[model samples]
Target: MIRWAASLGLILAITLAAPGAHGQSPAGAYETLRLIDGVRVLMNPADHASFASSNVVIIEQADGLVVVDSGFSRADGDQIVSYIRSFTAKPVKALIYTHWHNDHHQGASQIQAAWPQVRIIATEAARRGIDGPARLEGVGYETNPAWEALLAGQLRDVAARYQEAAANPENDAWRRHRFGQAAQQSLDGIPALVGTRLTAPTELFTADLVIDDPLRPVHIRHLGRANTDGDLIVWLPNQRVVATGDIVVSPIPFGFGSYPGDWIETLGRIKALGFHVLIPGHGLPQSDSAYIDRLIAAIADIRTRVGALAAEGLTLEQVRERVDYAEQTAIFGPSPARQANFQSLWLSPMTENAYKEATGVPIVQGQGELP
Candidate 1:
């Protein structure tokens, strides 16, 4: 069981986490967060991407369970499947690819091996994205589990600091938001990321499609481009739940592949869907209306901040820090840490460089700091 803690009169609290009771490091242990009765989200951490955390969701349907995104490797996939098995014996009926990022969909091969009948579904762009040349050659976790383990400790410490701040009366609301935001930011820097052979999808689509089962009727719609050029939203009209890929991570939206204009428009589209339970690619699920409001506010703030940086010709690092993720994070909340999380996957320099060149700015080389 997950232990949540807080202390009195302390503005800051600490959440002490231990390795899996069975002796596995915290990185391999899959912490399952049940979103609802039949829906669950998995948080997998690793030293990859500087030891950040990643998320995956599994939805149980009447026919079989539908997996939203897979984890980083066969090992990670096995851990996820093991967690699912602990809950129910149902096989995966369908594997849904929210986007083609490896962290989001690399476990398909293992899952398919277990459930060959499972159908693979994703957007056309997501399909190609998974099969692209940039695919990982091998696993990310085993590359440096020791160092990754050390990094995971730091993230845990960061999380602890965040929790501590959240308990302070004066910092309560603000710290909670920052904690969440920091969670999202911390996800990008994990170093233990294991590269994967990649499990590609079998089917793809370009338009809105409906996933109907006796259990639920999910309408998945694409919003031109946001998190990626081919991002999509999975909506459960009846359950009033929606799975928004990476388009809307907690604390703030990941802007690596973001077309600011399109991202903003996508937020409007999500709001129009009116899902009460909004499940983001990372972070906790939120209410549809409330989340839509939160998204709009955060994205607008990012736009304003980035726009100012662009106007002033500030570099990406200067630009990165100029846009205070802390404020938005304080308001929205933090995401979990995982290897190859969206923070690393989405915040690629290639994407950012492209965005800059497209906007007529000089290009820069390197991962973190902008030129």
Candidate 2:
């Protein structure tokens, strides 16, 4: 059974420090926010960048420590380990994966190397999904020189945009400039993946599993499919906090291989948990349910709008044109660039997924060539 805490103040007291403070590189600097007693959130600096990183939750237990999610690459894992050691000398006893996303669990190998005895835990579905083919086709572009060159060209174009944005001196321009810098930093970390090893989960659960610790009873639950089929949310009941893997990403939600219908229901369940703090898979730690509410509303809106368009005999392309995400774009960001990014990242895929779900179209997995 899941337990709920009573009225814990959800204060957002984040302490952003440079990685150099801990002898790490500036590019690897992460924001460490103490959510509550014995619970901290380590958020990657390049969060807004593409394939940037995931937010890692650290729970200091009685015996050692429990890590909610590993990060994007081996270097990210090393940075996480160093950050943990800065304050506590306790060994990481268990590494709990929120989902099977490469950005979330790929760093498990580094954690394992640091502590060989650490038990890696994930849902049974996630365990299988990890070893499966890449979620989106043509995603592994690191191995292809042509793809790499294409990405490099795109990066250069973005750099040019950043330079233009930097001269504007507006808040939006500043935000764009920062995002460009972060994206460059994230790109720089790609070389670390050359020899990085991705470790699989040593322990798997079907429904729910508790990390039977007297001091901190960590409850891991699979609340239907949201981000992926194996999505898991780590509930720290005592601390009134929940680590909502990719289920509740901020700025904009990711819909690749997502179940839009089930995702809304899952968000409801998360809200029912009454968590004071939400540690999302990406972005910063949220103190209120506003962001989650927005995510739920967005998914619900897509299902309704897209379903209506499909029912009206409109094709996928037609539906995409008809369904204007004006509201979502306004809330997430109103800029043309932000709107385009959001549409490409979430809206486009979501529309197609929602249409498939509405029209009873089968989802074709592993159809395209691997990049």
List candidate 2 stretches off by more than 4 Å: 1-25, 46-50, 134-183, 335-337, 364-371
lDDT of 2 by residue, 1-371 (tens): 00000000000001111111222335545678787889988875433333345788999888899998877666778888888889988999999988766667767777888899999999988876666533232434123444334334543544455455445556365455554554465456456554344577889988898886777788999989887778899998887889998898766666666788889999999999999988887666778889878888888888999999999999999998889788777666565444534654677768888999999986432121110
RMSD of each: 9.9, 8.4
RMSD to native, candidate 2: 8.4
Using Cα atoms with residue i matched to residue i, what is each candidate's TM-score against the true structure? 0.64, 0.79
lDDT of model 1, residue 165: 45
lDDT of 2 at 86: 95
Query: Which consecutive 10 residues in model 2 have the weakest lDDT in total?
Result: 4-13
Displacement of residue 240 (Cα, Å) in model 2 is: 1.4
In candidate 2 the C-alpha lDDT for residue 257 amounts to 64
Instruction: Report lDDT per candidate.
Output: 0.56, 0.68
Write model 1 residue lDDT over 1-371, tens digit each, in one string: 00100000010111111011112234344566777877787753321111223467788888778888775445566777778788788888888888754456656667877888888889888765554423332223223344344434545665555555446566446445645544443443343233334555676788888767887766767877765667888787777888887776653345443565667788888888767787777555776467667666666665665666667877766666555555554543443421112333323332353336445654311112211
